[model samples]
Target: MKNKSIQIQEKHHKELQKLSESLGQSYGGLVEKMILYFKRTGIDPDDLKNESPTYKIQQLDKRLVSFLKVQERAILKPLRQETYEYYENHNKTLKEAKSLINKKIVQADQNSKIRTNNILKEIDKQREALNSICEHLDPANKKGLKTVFQNIFKNAN
Candidate 1:
């Protein structure tokens, strides 16, 4: 295709150059990129010409515009609908997964609490058994046994 050139102000030219640099592109390349971007975004850059007060309606090929309109609708309509549907389903699935995870977390926490309570009860039983054994010992033997039992209980606690 043949390319055309347009004149821009020096300030705009400098700005374009900076933009091109930031985008890792050349000035001409940047213009081409912008054209493609506008096309993809469904914005006709030519339509902006109407902003000028003195602008005249150029001869537009009606058949070409109609064809483009039909093609655009054919291509974009279903895609837009499908995109919305996809997001709707995706969000629903995400919420379901989060709910499942939360349920599992609550169950795990309850299990952990039950296990901790059982462990504490077992330790109390052991302490009671030690006290009963100390009570049945002779006075001389009780002193040394009581000290050992106290050390064990302190360490366990």
Candidate 2:
């Protein structure tokens, strides 16, 4: 093995010595173990990978996204329910309006039919009065203007 020398601050060396004592290792042995750990993990011993705020922020971002998804579902559930209820109420109202319109249409048809029947009855009474006048004018024969008037009245009826 080759010997190498590296200089460190006095305070850092003292801290290293304290760590070495706590670990029940010589300072040089502790340094060797740290170097071995770096070689095995392919990481620098001084790098605060897990303890850095950047890593904690990334974890917090993931948890925040999950929490937002839960909140989104919780908020949308009531909105969806209200939307469904609104449409259902509108549909029922539309159905009621349609039925009312249909009833009005039926009533109008019945009224038109009644009016038509009344007009027909009036026409029949007018024809009968004309026929009675024709009978008065030609009581003896069944021919001439009385026959023509009877034919016209039959066709009209």
Candidate 3:
């Protein structure tokens, strides 16, 4: 489409720019859409010229363009900045938590391996102790050795 320039107030242009961004359209497209809406609603664009003075005055009193500018500068801009900061902090916290979780997982794995190794070592020690007792006990001393083994099992339980 061919582009044409028209004179419009700065605040009106800013409002249009904001509207364009929000609607994801060019300012010209937005204007075209607005015109289409008016046409479909049976409102004649030319009739604006014959509008009552009070209605026109009320339109001016609304100060929508100024309101949009104030909202952009005083409220929206700061809110946007704070939103960015919030995301940054939230992302940082998530990363740190992930790192901590991974570290804990690794530590748990290491602890599990150590516990297994300790259990194996204890088994080996008990086997060696049993072998020593068997080797030391003669046939005549077997009864005493059997009593000692039964007491060891009782203590184990």
In angstroms, the error of model 1 at 69 is 2.7
Question: How would you encode candidate 3's per-residue C-alpha lDDT over 82-118 as one tens digit per residue?
Answer: 9999999999999999999999999999999999999
Winner on lDDT (2 vs 3): 2
Cα shift from native, residue 10, model 3 (Å): 44
Query: TM-score of every model?
Result: 0.50, 0.57, 0.48
Error of 1 at 37 (Å): 40
Q: Score residue 89 of candidate 1 by CA lDDT.
A: 100
Question: In candidate 3, which residue pairs clash?
Answer: none
Query: In terms of lDDT, which candidate is strongest?
Result: 2
**Compared to the true structure, candidate 3 yields what TM-score?**
0.48
Task: Please give, for residues 25-118, the per-residue lDDT of candidate 2 as tens digits.
Answer: 9877899998897788676656766354577789899999999888878987778999999999999999999999999999999999999999
State residue 21's C-alpha deviation in candidate 3, in Å: 48
Q: If both were scored by TM-score, which would come out higher, candidate 1 or candidate 3?
A: 1
Q: CA shift at 3, candidate 2, in angstroms? A: 20
